[model samples]
Target: MSFEWPWQYNFPPFFTLQPNVDTRQKQLAAWCSLALSYCRHHKLYTLDIMEAQESPVFNHKNIDRKLSMEAILIVFEELRKKGNLEWLDKNKTRCLVMWRRPEEWGKLIYQWVSKNGMVNTVFTLYELANGDDTESEEFHGLEDWMLIRSLQALQMDGKAEVISMDDGKGVKFF
Candidate 1:
């Protein structure tokens, strides 16, 4: 979806803890939907839970209101349980917001490899992410950690294998 804000976007109660159980549930749902849309629109793949209050959508400049860290943590926990975000650290402070899940990304890469006759080819992680040939790819310039996660997903399906080189890791699509 586009970046259209919901009618409840700027509603003051949207930022705080709700007393009623039903209201709180609805509020959490709204928060998650809003966050998903906003992050997708911005092509943001991660959400720093601790810094959310200072980030867009969470920080409301016009109303001078921001979600407290506690509120952010609560909503983030709900989002995590829904499989829309993954905790990056054991502390539950940083999250890898899965606007597009890593498994899907791995499939996309596999398709690209097949279409381009890259299967059975050994390519460094660097090449798959930043080579001139992949400049136009959707996952071009992807961060190394995220790229590895995607590759690991492929490995689970017997689609790829990783080779440790002196410089870095390489992937053999099969």
Candidate 2:
């Protein structure tokens, strides 16, 4: 699937940080939206600052414009404040991006289980993510860390329980 770039992406001025506070705020907002949409379309759960700077989303080769590293940091910082990103290191080079919150993912999983009448059934993490039954599901191909977080969200709501077994971890939906 191809990601559609926002209109701002092609605007050369959008690549630079604006001197005006209000303009900068609007610019940052646009950047945050673009970044989240791009990551979601690519199914990217993690991001590296250097890698992102080179990615098409931030680098508009057609326009010969690229967002400055400092601007990217500001955009990411905004995302973090909005609860959509989490830094993974002190250097802030790597981060986890949550386009959809764990609670939202948990709700989707729970709804699927209920709709399929699979409630009360134990399912291995792999099965939920990569099993044939879930191949056509949105959560299919979900990374284990994100999967665990989604299950944990469900557990907090008393809709699911994560079990650690000898073979691996599993989950039981209530």
Candidate 3:
């Protein structure tokens, strides 16, 4: 007797979690690629596990499979191991999707400062965050911590200096 297999039939076992490491690695890579693409396209800078609706990894409807927080953490941990993701907060709830690193951010800031003649100029942190002087396609609406860390990194390298003013609102960068 000969048996015929349906070429287009959906197999429930295909969705079942595989135990093999190689298969799991491939699955993770695909998922990460999709997640990263979605995040980048949406300009998403942070992901919150507690608030899962915004995350693409958890909002998929095709398979009726929702990723648990633990699963999401494991995948994020793997991405971190591969240097593709970074945790921005102490609780590990908010992550910085580091397609570019802090060093790169520092370099971009330095270039912008040089290009726009912002060096030797006195500006406040609030100004930097929402200033007309630094208004441009880049560095606009940049996060405070990321900007400070990038500036500090530049300062450590002797490329720039940060000066504090008496008003408690001004931080000059030169």
Candidate 4:
């Protein structure tokens, strides 16, 4: 037996907000999951609302189905409040999504260093980012600010020390 569509109707202008809390919660959860996964996969540390590409809101193809900037901001703000994201600047134009927080990055760096027998070896931050000796799969092309922040966190834990190079163009980690 084959099933056939019994009802063929187009409902236009159904301006009704969902009143069920459970349904709304489920919807919100789904949206959040998509947003976070997108951010993580793209390594989008920062998101700018004015910049349409950075924001998940705004759809160029479907103008009628676009999400308002205010709505997008609300979702980002909620994420920030929950400690999942942070504003990089005062204007709130850019946001840093904490898929993996600084503390976790610090631990990972420490583990990598210990595992690779680089605990006491002195190396520049740039070297860590693009070094042939280091794990190219992990730290290559990583954001400098993120790497520095992670190193600083490790420093606080006495896991590593950051020193300024003589040239002032780079930093050495020991």
Best by lDDT: 2
Kindly provide the TM-score of model 2 when superposed on the true structure, using C-alpha atoms: 0.96
Clashes of each: 0, 0, 0, 0
Encode model 1's per-residue lDDT on 80-134: one tens digit a residue.
8898888989998788887677898899889999999989999989899999988
TM-score of 1: 0.86
Q: Residue 80: error of model 1 in Å? A: 1.7
Q: Rank the candidates by TM-score, best first.
A: 2, 1, 4, 3
lDDT of 3 by residue, 70-172 (tens): 6677778877887878887788887877555667777887787778787877667677767786777466666766677677788888776766667544444
**Residue 142 of model 3: what lDDT?**
65
List candidate 2 stretches off by more than 4 Å. Answer: none
**What lDDT is reached at residue 106 by model 1?**
95
Q: What TM-score do all the candidates reach, one by one? A: 0.86, 0.96, 0.70, 0.71
lDDT of each: 0.86, 0.93, 0.64, 0.62
Q: Write one digit per residue (lDDT tens) for candidate 2, span 56-162.
A: 98898999999889889999999999999999999999999999999999999999999999999999999999999998888888888889999999999999999
C-alpha lDDT of residue 37 in model 2: 92
- TM value for model 4: 0.71
